[model samples]
Target: MPIVMDVDALMEFLRREFPQVSEDFVIEEVTEELTTVRLAVGERHLRPGGTVSGPTMFALADVGIYLAILARLGPVALAVTTNCSIDFLRKPASGRDLVSKTRILKLGRVLVVGDVLIYSEGDDRPVARASLTYSIPPRA
Candidate 1:
């Protein structure tokens, strides 16, 4: 399906609806095939070893897919993650921002399935991979 919301619209919706995490994510690119998002990694995202934390990577994946869904479905704020399975493949580069590339695997009426690959900015290898399922609320 064609995208209903572009990057600017998605960013604005995020800022207005989810202010707490709005500043942390950058909606880099949105297309019919994929959505790219960046996490501005900071001190708080690091772990004891100075590497990016698992929870932080998971957040990137979750938010990335959420934005992807919104791009196609338009600000569907009620859409929520119903399931997520993630695998940490490698330790993320320390002090580097992380980027997630998300694509919809299946876009059904009630459920949307997506895949996300997370990498430290400028890196070729993915540090983590996630598959997520989101439940889209029925229209009123």
Candidate 2:
């Protein structure tokens, strides 16, 4: 399927609905099969070890898949993550941005499943991988 919502439209919808997290992430690209999203990591995202925290990476994965689903299904604000499993493979770059490449595995009426690979900017290998399932609300 074609993307129903592009990056700018999706970002606007997110800014209007989820203002708190809107500033941390940017929807760089959106398409039928893939979505590229960026996390503007900051000092607050770091842990005691001077590395990006797991929760921060998890947020990036969740938002990446969420936006991918929205790009395909339009601005469905009620769609929520039903399940998520993330594996942190390597430490993220402290001074660079992080990017997520998200791809849909399944798209159904009530649920969407997708995988996300997060990599530090300019890196070829993923720093983390995540599988996410989202529950899409019924049409009103």
Candidate 3:
């Protein structure tokens, strides 16, 4: 599918519909097959061990794929994640921005599937991998 929204437009869409979290994520790259997003790691995002937490990374992948879906389908406000499976491969580096690079695997009328690899910024190894399934709302 061709892209219906770019990085700036996706950011704008998030800000307009989901203002509470729009600031937590940065839309870095958007395209037909891939969408990249970054989370600015703050002290609150760290675990007791001073490493980025799993939930934080999960949120990154969730939001990144949401943008990937929106980029293809426009602003479908009711689209929701039907399922997600994630693996934490390694400890994420501390106090660095986390980046989620998401690739869409399937886009159907009601379901979307995508794979996400999350890295601690500047690291070559992925800290986690996720496969997500989203349910798209039907149009009226």
Candidate 4:
């Protein structure tokens, strides 16, 4: 299927619907099978050891998959995450923005499963990997 939402449109939809988190994420690219996003790493995203926090990484994965699903389904604001499994493989580079490379494993009427690999910006190795399942809201 063709992508219903492009990066610019998806960014607008996110800003309009979820302003609180809109600025935290930047949509880099969007396609039917893949989506790329960046997290603007800041002071709040770090932990006591000066490394990126786990929750921040998890947030990136979640948002990446969410946007991937939305790319195919349009501005379906009601889609929600139902399950996630994440592995933290390495420490993220300090003060560098993180990138999430996401792809869909399955897209269904009520659910979409996505896999994500996260890396520090400019780094070649992944810092974490995640598998997420989102429950798409039923159409009216």
Who wins the lDDT comparison?
1
Tens digit of lDDT per residue, candidate 4, span 11-70? Answer: 999899989999999999987767999999999999999999999999999999988988
Clashes of 4: 0
- Give the runs in model 2 whose Cα sits over 4 Å from its true position: none
lDDT of 2 at 24: 94
* Per-residue accuracy of model 2 over 38-62 as CA lDDT, tens digit each: 9998999999988999999999999
Clashing pairs in 2: none
lDDT of 1 by residue, 1-47 (tens): 99999999999999999999999999999999999999999998888
Point out where model 4 deviates above 4 Å. Answer: none
> Model 4, 96: alpha-carbon shift in Å?
0.6
lDDT of each: 0.96, 0.93, 0.92, 0.93
lDDT of 3 by residue, 1-140 (tens): 99998898899999999898889999988877789999999988888989988888889999999999999999998999999999999999876899999999999989999999999899989999999999999887
The root-mean-square deviation over C-alpha atoms between each candidate and the true structure, in angstroms, is 0.6, 0.8, 0.8, 0.8
How much is 105 displaced in model 3, in angstroms?
0.3
